[model samples]
Target: MDIQTILQELELLSTERTKKTYIRNGAHEPLFGVATGAMKPLAKKLKKNQGIAEELYATGNYDAMYLAGMIADPSAMSEADFDRWMGTAYFYMISDYIVAVTLAETDIAQAVSDKWIASGKELFMSAGYSCYCWLLGNRKDEEFDQEKLNKMLEIVEKTIHNSPNRAKYAMNNFVTTVGISYMPLHERAVAVANAIGKVEVSSVKTKCNVPLASEAIQKAVDKGQLGFKRKNVRC
Candidate 1:
């Protein structure tokens, strides 16, 4: 389907009420405020079209950019594409979910993640941590640098308490991903989560709280569901 049709469909699916609700979650205007769940069928229809995704993303509409990430082909993407996407990613949902997921599957995942994290931009750093979460969840233990991950976990343990706004929350997510997705790191993740304790971030009117990493991990463990890796991290 064409971009115009996709956008029209998004508008049909959007509501002013939902737009305001998304605003609370940090969505910028010129968005249809279509929920992520509502966008999946569209993504399925669009499939993975790198050129079209780039076109939609460049429109600067929040929902379209987000959908671009979902439908874009990461295998055909380069570091330059990520750089461009990052420049446009002002929304947390787009940055952390869309940009991060696509980048995490690339061969240069670690390099890109490190560069973004070092930038210390809130969204970039959050996306970087999110990349790590996806990487750890999808890769086998031997495929990555074990020592580096340990040190990264240590960094989270030490600095998560003082990390910037959403970065702390993203770091907490890294801990949860490690605990629930990587079997060998479960103990270490739990320890790190315990040490970090409660994570506080800016409030949403939805009253949704930042989940404690420890409890989140434990819930998975209690259900005998810990250590299972996801087939894919894309939404």
Candidate 2:
């Protein structure tokens, strides 16, 4: 219900080993080493409380910031709140997942995505690409601007290989997300991914490899997972 209470809960969930691992993955101190799975039940209990969510994010605690995303009412949050969150985020997961998901749920998604991608900040640009990924995956064709989307694909084609590490990774994920989820864009997205080939994202802690976008989408197609729209981006 409050920052102290949630922080305490998260603290109890922290483990020294996980803390060390998280630090290597780009998270800093003041974060409890709580697993994301552990945060979900807590987030569910605090769901839809924008005020509490804001307080949690302002704590600058990684676990709490991620919790804020789970509880946020994206529709209720003002654009100013998102702006603050995006600009202040100190971790990749906060920017790429929490901030991106909230932005996708709002009407200003594409506008902010464009603005952030154009910025010099790596975090903002990564978040922007991540937001676009969610936007393209969850929204219907009628709701999207074909011109802008087309332009984004072109930008990826031209700049993805030279993008900042996380930005390149996010862009690749965006390609797979669109190619796998949007039927009409599948061919184009695959073409772009094939042309870009394997992407490299620097990760110090995780074994997670950046999948070739084309192969990832192709796997989805093989499993008949293509063309499935996610009703919500939170998952």
Candidate 3:
């Protein structure tokens, strides 16, 4: 479908309740607040379309931007394209879920994420860590370097508490993901999780506690889900 027709459909799928929830989570105007699940049928129809995805993303509508991620051709996107998208990703959902998730599918995922992680910017760091989480959870353990993951666990242990709110959450998830999904660094990740403890994330609504990586990893262990790998990262 054309962008205009897709946008009209997204508008029709929007609800007041979801709009309020999006606003509460930092989304501004020019959004339809269409639920992610609600976009699946449309996504299925559109598949991967880089041209249309760019148009939708340029609209600056939350739902459109989200749909852009759903249909974007990650292989067609250059590092510059991903960086351009990240530049305008104003919030965690867009940065972590959309930009990072899309980047995870690319061959440059690690290199791009490394630069973002070291960028010292909040959402960039968050998206960078989140991309690792996505990568570790979906890719085979053999694809990662054991030493690199070990160093990352050490970084998380040392800086999680001092990291930005969103980055702290992603960093915590990264540790847990390494523990559960990457057998090479499981023990080190467990130690890092034990050292980091609970992470507190502050927002306008309240101070939320990011789950302890140790506890989350242990739950996966108890369920015999250690060394787990997801079949896909994107919905």
* TM-scores for all predictions: 0.92, 0.92, 0.97
Question: After TM-score superposition, what is the CA distance of residue 49 in candidate 2 from its true location, in Å?
Answer: 0.9
Give per-residue CA lDDT, model 3, range 1-235, as digits (tens). 7889999999999999999999999899899889999999999999999999999999999999999999999999999999999999999999999999999999999999999999989999999999999999999988988888888888888888998998998899999999999998888888888998889999877988998899999999999999998899899
lDDT of 2 at 101: 87
Which residue runs of candidate 3 sit more than 4 Å off their true CA positions? none
Model 1, position 224, has a per-residue lDDT of 95
Model 2 has a clash total of: 0
User: Evaluated with lDDT, which candidate comes out highest?
Assistant: 3
lDDT tens string, model 2, 57-148?
Answer: 88888888888898888898776778899877887788988999888999888888888899857889899989988887788877876667
**In model 1, what lDDT does residue 19 have?**
89
Q: Cα deviation in Å at residue 85, candidate 2?
A: 0.4
Give residue 72's error in model 3 in angstroms: 0.6
How many clashes (backbone atoms < 3 Å, residues ≥3 apart in a chain or on different chains) does model 1 have?
0
Which pairs clash in model 3?
Answer: none
> What CA RMSD would candidate 2 show?
2.1
Off by over 4 Å in 2: 203-209
Q: Tell me model 1's lDDT, rounded to 2 decimals.
A: 0.86
